[model samples]
Target: MAMSNAGNDYPLSEVPPEARKGLASLAMVLLGFTFFTATMFAGGKLGVAFGFADLLLVIALGNLLLGLYAAALGHIACRSGLNSVLMGRFAFGERGSKLCDLILGFTQIGWYAWGTATAAVVLGKYFGLEQGAVLALMAVFGLGFCATAYIGYRGLEILSWIAVPAMALLLILSMSVTTAKAGGLAGLLAIQPSSSLDLSTAITLVFGTFVSGATQATNWTRFARSTRVAVLASLIGFFIGNGLMVLIGAYGAIVYQQPDVVEVLMLQGFATAALAMLLLNIWSTQDNTIYNFAVAGCNLVRTDRRKTVTLAGALIGTALAVLGMYDLLVPYLVLLGTVIPPIGGVIVADFWLRHRGRYPLLAEARLPHYNWPGLAAYGLGTIAAFGSPWVAPLVGIGVAALAYGVFNGLTRGRTTAPASL
Candidate 1:
């Protein structure tokens, strides 16, 4: 099938060298993606459960692990000039790649639905709007949020440049107020936890909160001009940016017993700032989420109509949002943590171990229909993760990679290697 690149953001092909981006642009875009409200909420949960010192440690360790995972994938993406979905063709094979498309595409749309619902519900409460008005707002915001995604990479970059700084300022302002109210670092140390949670669970919450996003971050990292840029940008975004979000949430929770930054701002008499923060926070991530959906959708159907798929996805997300995606956040997040990380594990193992860190161009590579080793490895990994009592995402990645290595070794010399077109 001949693939089209018009307004499609190279969904089926490697990004050309001339189109690669510098570190600053890529980092800013990723930072914008990571400055999410849900992450803050997760931090808020940890904040209430652990003391300030312990909370910081958990945040550090969790975000550090998340950052390392993203950096590894970013390295692969930078080298290949293809995102996870495109890379799936090599690991999962030609027809088997659709499994990745479905999994990734479904998760992105789920996120889109949750974000749309969150925007509508939060805005509605703040404005004293009726339930009908809230649903209408969901429809409006759901479609509106896809505007940047519809325009593709340049659109995401422009929006990020504007939103990242504004969000940083708002977060700093809220944290400063929270500190003053809590009587500074000394007073924060004096506070006692109202809840009990183990260190392992706290770390899992932090890591799982954004593992899906980290996995999909290759969508932007593939644009990096060099591997160093990719790795650094991944750390900046997943570590620094996500860490800040978690810190702010924890701070607010400890000070005001609220995990949401926007609500914390409202409590601090910054109603206007809260509104601005809400819009910027949700819009930035929403666009990126839908953009991810479009990329996966394009690959799923083997089509180049990204804009069309984006619109269709927006509608589907809107319908889901209206149907109550907001209330489903906890279960949805749990599902994401279990299922998403193993896909990345398989991709990494396939790229580095099977292909020896190099992949033939997608257009010129003739691959098999089903790579059973990859699929079976993914299943084994997912089962291990779901059954493990420890951190599920980490288990999923490790088991998946190890299983892939074993399977690939056993299958070597029995199956034919992929051919060049």
Candidate 2:
């Protein structure tokens, strides 16, 4: 179908006739995986704070399951050209969709800021620069990200080509060095985690990590030419890319005595690989996030989608580069981490229960401008994600699903039409 600008606009239908390519398509699948690997490593560091071997196991298992679910998210994005955030519109109403966009967009900003800051610090420490100098360095990188984002998704796709391979090599190199340092795989296996794992916590971590990876699937899937390609690419990302990154990251804790030390090993393998990987990884991830924001704008306004997305990226990227943004971004990151899973739950439930092989959401003109049920369910999900102590983040998602199901069932008769791409 030709893209119609007369109604609600979205990129899945707006992408020019020739912008799609196999490499660019595959990069979309890897985008979320990159962020996920970073989170798993960070989560492992946090797991260390808990101090129980069993807990780590539980978390690892939870993250694994979540990863599987995330891998499947590509089906939605690729099948529908709608970016993930905009996909919510059919379920949440156009206005309600804005909430999803705002939250996800902010989370992306945090990722960009945290990543740029991290790279700056890594570089600064390596060069023996002072704290003040590190902040300055991050500012420079942040500007570069903004500049690239402003050029649009095409530019981002090119950046991803460079980043994905670099990150893969860094991951491989880290695993090799860590194994060698620990006296090989056998020796690394012998070293045990000091943390304990309960089934619930483990499940939460596994799912948490999975949702984390999935958040970007829709953005990339929007470019996929076919559902089969999208699903296959996503499987590779979930099973191959993420599997290796986590296996290496988690094992790094045992072998290197510090997971973050993976970078140290990278530095040793070839000078600057660590820094290069860090920069490229963040660049790859940030561009996808920026693309989603652009799509969100297309949904909200009739103006040029690319320009709006670029403006959003520039503003968010610059804010993230400013001093002390990382410290503030951490809590929000955790909140975003929690907020995402419920969305996956709703997406899965909506696809399975409400649509049942028919995408009611693909026809924008037929959709109600305001879907209170969707809005209510979305709010309930966020609230649910907020309640748990150990995994309060998931509360919103779990609760939202149940609430939506119950509400939709009781009503039993609203023929909500899907948004058309």
Candidate 3:
């Protein structure tokens, strides 16, 4: 299909022309906070229960590594304006790129399904509905998501702007209240259970919770005006915003010592706050899933791109929702979480190690069409990640990076390099 984009690039184009700086930054920041509530409280709560110091250490380290890779991939998306699946062509060749898209599309479908289910759960609880009713609400949410998917990135950006701040404010307010209830920041810190979390589990959860967010990051970064904004946005999003969210979880843990404090806190004074937080969290994350799925769907069809996206969203959403598998979202997220780090590892290796200082594959329109070596490397990375549950997702990521770097050295001799020196 012939594609055009006035002066700017088309939605799934390979190169995006310059855009408004503030808009780009705003979009990214908003995107960053989509998982703020979930990641912060959920991951942090797990950490505090396991061990506070250990959890903080785990979170810090995971964020640092995850941030580096996310920022790099995000920079590429921002500067190139290519939907991430299209960008994979630069790394995976044509057929390999297709496979990458399918993998990404499938994973994104899972994410969207999970997000829909989460939205349903939140809405159900807020409205005092039953599970069956929640499923109906989930369907409605899924429909809204599909509608937004059709409207494209502009709609997503607007949704991001509205939902991001709403979520953030709720997070801040909840954390503040939890802290005050606990006595203060110091008091919150002092409260610890008899059996604390181990250091490794805490760190793994930190990496695990945000792994999905990190993987889907390019969906928003593609709109960035510059690499600086991309990196800064990620830094703020993952580091600062992530820190605040985790602290909220920690604060919740400290204030409520009971077994089901997560539930209790929501029902107590934090009910309204939790509902807002839940809705915002679900919407924010859902937007990204919808956006990426749209991109992947467009790439898959390459004809009637808009219709392709709508169809893909509906089919995937319906299948998942019908399965009534909301409870499965977290486990699936954990699985994807482990799978993604390795992809990030390969991206780092490809962009940084082999390419030297330029993105030759991106610059060139064509490459050796079937890049089997890249596939092998990615496969090996996947294998490694799957086997390394103890380390969570890092195992696969590490393996993928090494395999890609070594394979690139032996086969292609590093034609492409990082855009930044």
Candidate 4:
């Protein structure tokens, strides 16, 4: 977490080759990204909407798709040794990349607030506490959540060491208990969906839970030793780790009519277990979320004041959670799910197609002030994404890629100094 060395500049000009890691270490870090409680909540929504078979199909294929997308970016990151916001510098321009930093970073704040609010409100609920007390609890939890992010990636890796395995065991326990309550998987398959949600919407929600995070896959994957390591790590983290979260959430919803894994655990008379689950599950994600905000903020402001920026970000996100502004951000988060993937699309195009899968050094990569082609592609992609409901995020990605290829084919735009300076 001590990102004080020139070799590891704040926001990372490039991860030194000597610092690169193999599949195991990178996988561990990427795994932290998938260990998100919101994924479980999204799974619960799908559980209520579709039958057992349908739900399994949605979760598997939906996340597999996202995993592949993230892996693609991971490959790019490992090859270039660049994080997402820095990649935006190539595709979106030095100044235009700030938009990438803002959109990607602020979304993390929204997630931070939402995760904090959920944890606090539920913790308060079990105590039969009032809304005012719940708000106070949000502040307390928010501070605790910000601690790791303040330390950066090292903090995330350390927290994941204890939290990931413990959280997985609890989820498995909850599944076992719930499966028994449903008289086993056969009976669970027989349970009818309480409501109908279209397959497209369910899949969208599945990806939406982590698509923004998916775009940011480069953040951790830059640590990978090779493209193979990056790709495999991302696939395992998002596919297996993320898939399990959805399955657990779906299982809880189908058997107990509860959308929350922690709530279901509590209802099963594992109140203490639920508390542990709440702390580990939400805390693992909250710290990472705030850490992400710090990185993005540092990129946006072009500063090395990551700790100061982290504190400011935590204060802003905590205030939003306590004031209930996170509720207002939820719909926006959904819209962001549709809008943000285009950034990835353009980056993929610029990295693979335009550059032929190679890039100049980040410190010396002369780029345009504004890559209008990339921005235009993203704009068109976002519009096209909302025009239909069938796989909105994927649609955005495809449109952005195609449009970027077309626009980037034009004469080279004016080049400028790299933002890393």
**What are the RMSD figures for all models against the true structure?**
2.1, 4.2, 3.6, 2.7
C-alpha root-mean-square deviation, candidate 3:
3.6
lDDT of 2 by residue, 227-303 (tens): 67776666566655555555555655665555563354654565566666666666666655555556555555534
TM-score of 4: 0.94
Which structure among the candidates has the greatest lDDT?
A: 1
Candidate 4: misplaced stretches above 4 Å? Answer: 1-3, 6-9, 130-132, 412-421
Where does candidate 1 stray beyond 4 Å?
1-6, 413-421
lDDT by residue for model 3 (99-198), tens: 7667677777777787777667766766789878876787787877666556655655666677767666766665566667767756645766555656
The TM-score ranking, best first, is 1, 4, 3, 2
Which 10 residues in a row give candidate 1 its minimum summed lDDT? 412-421
Is candidate 2 or 4 superior in lDDT?
Answer: 4
Cα lDDT tens digits, model 4, 145-178, are: 8887777767777887788888878888888989
Q: Which stretches of candidate 2 lie over 4 Å from their true place?
A: 1-24, 27-37, 46-64, 130-133, 210-213, 266-269, 297-303, 360-364, 389-399, 415-421
lDDT of 4 at 146: 86
Q: After superposition, how far is residue 263 of candidate 4 from its true place, in Å?
A: 1.1
Could you give the candidate ranking by lDDT, starting with the highest? 1, 4, 3, 2
- Model 2 scores a TM of 0.82
Q: Which clashing pairs does model 4 show?
A: none
Give the C-alpha lDDT of model 2. 0.60
